[model samples]
Target: MSDAIVVIPTYNEIENIEAIIDAVFAQEKAFHVLVVDDNSPDGTHQKVIELQEKYPERLFLEVREAKTGLGTAYIHGFRWVLARDYEYIFEMDADFSHNPEDLVRLLAACQEDGFDVAIGSRYVKGVNVVNWPMNRVLMSYFASKYVRFITGIPIHDTTAGFICYRRKVLETIGLETIRFVGYAFQIELKFKAWKLGFKIKEVSVIFTDRTKGKSKMDSSIFSEAVFGIIKMKIRSMFTKTKPHA
Candidate 1:
């Protein structure tokens, strides 16, 4: 098994699952994948199973009965990876928005460079997103700024789903206490890591909107992130912060 495992959360992502898995495996670096499928009726899980036959050791799957929140899926994957011997655990999307090629750079940021968490950031290099409306681009950009102002975390892309974390960092953070399941969940995890004195590095990447699959973004997820940041910030005041691992 590889030292790294990439966890991808999927819903109705049948159109993108196969290609994404292939793209990840095609990378020069050795990285295993775990697909946390929420019982996609579109047969997303079956596609993963088929791929697993070819990459028996590199590819794995976890199917759930019903659709749960994205945060829970990742939390489950994190716990599973921790139980094993993976040195680096990643969070990625089943949709092809996040570039698979950038996984190398993310890994380098931690393995070669000295960073505890590496974020595949879209905004660190001046809005590296394509095929998105101006409104959405602004919302996402400003959202990160808002999160930064509220939490005092110096991350550029606060809601970036593509991230690589060293095993020790995840083990240090109390994963069970993670609350929000929407986009805010991303921010919360990063905030807790930063609060605990983990060094986070942002690797510039281009985020292209997925062409084949439907988007999961909605007003509710945005609202959760907007309000959740305040709660997360306030809670951090009372709670004792964990030091760097």
Candidate 2:
């Protein structure tokens, strides 16, 4: 069995689910994919079930009863995968926004190098984003900057969903205590890892806007990320967070 598992959360992603699964399998490096589907009404889970017949060992699925937050889906994936012996765990989007090709680069950062966490960063190298409007681009780029100033995390893209975490990093950060089920959820995980003194490396990756499906980004999600960081920082002061070994 492969040591790496990429946890992809899905909700009405039928347009891209089958293609993304095939793309991930096409990667040179072996990576097992776990689709945490939120019972996509568009039959996303059915597509995964059909493909499982072909790649049963490499592709797995966990269908949730309702649409929860992205953070909760990943937490479920972490617990499910951790029960096994996988060393590397990944979080990626079902949309084509996050390229499957970059999976190799992300895995390399933690597998070949000594970094505990690897991020597929867009702002790390002059905002490497494609097909996004200037305003949306600015909002995302500056959001990372704002998160850095507020949380003191050194990484450029704190809200990047395409990420790789060594088993030790996930094992260090308590998945149950993770707050903010929206965009802020991404920031919360990174902040906890930083506070624990884990090594984080950002590898440059181009984020393309998904053309096939609707975007999940909403104003409330952005607001949650902006305000949630402040509360997280305040809580960290009074709380005793555990560090990785």
Candidate 3:
């Protein structure tokens, strides 16, 4: 078995599911993939089942009963991987927004460079997003900036979903307590990791908007992120703990 596993959370991603799976498996590093698919009406989980025959032990699937928030889906995947022997656990998109080739770079940050968490950052070097309208881009770019300003987390891409976490980081962070389910979920994880003194590294990457399938971003997700940061910061102050790493 490979030491690394990429956990891809999916919902109604039939258009991109098969191709994304192939791109990830084609990588130079042997990375196992566990797809945590919320029961999609589009038969996305069925496609994964078919591909499983071809990939055998490398590709795995867990179908939840209904579509829930992205954070919970990832939490489920994290628990599943933690139960096994994998050392490197990743969070990636079913869409091509997150480059499959960059998986090697993220793995290097944790495995070779000894960082606890590696984020595939869009704003580290500059805003490296493609195919998105100017307004949406600004909202995302500024959102990260706002998060950095408020949370005192030095990360440039605090909301980036493309990430690699060394297994112990997750084990230490107390996954059961993770709040926010939308974009804020991304911010909350990074904040907690930083507060716990985990070393996080951002690997610059180009984030391309998906060509297929509908985008999941809505006003509620954005609003949650905007308001959630303050609440998170307030909550962190009262709680003090020793670093597990």
Off by over 4 Å in 2: none
Against the true structure, what is each candidate's TM-score? 0.98, 0.98, 0.99
Per-residue lDDT over 69-133 for candidate 2, one digit per residue giving the tens place of the 0 to 100 score: 88889888899999999999999999989999999899999999989999999998888999999
Candidate 1 backbone clash number: 0
Which parts of model 1 have CA positions greater than 4 angstroms off? none
Whole-model lDDT, model 3: 0.95
Output the worst ten-in-a-row residue range by lDDT, candidate 1. Answer: 236-245
lDDT of 2 at 217: 85
User: Any idea how many clashes model 3 has?
Assistant: 0
When 1 and 3 are scored with lDDT, the better candidate is 3
The whole-model lDDT of each prediction reads 0.93, 0.92, 0.95
TM-score of 2: 0.98
Task: Report the alpha-carbon TM-score of model 1 versus the true structure.
Answer: 0.98
Ordered from best to worst lDDT, the candidate numbers read: 3, 1, 2
Candidate number of the best lDDT: 3
Please give, for residues 78-162, the per-residue lDDT of candidate 1 as tens digits: 9888999999899999888999999999999999998999999999999999999999999999999999999899999999999
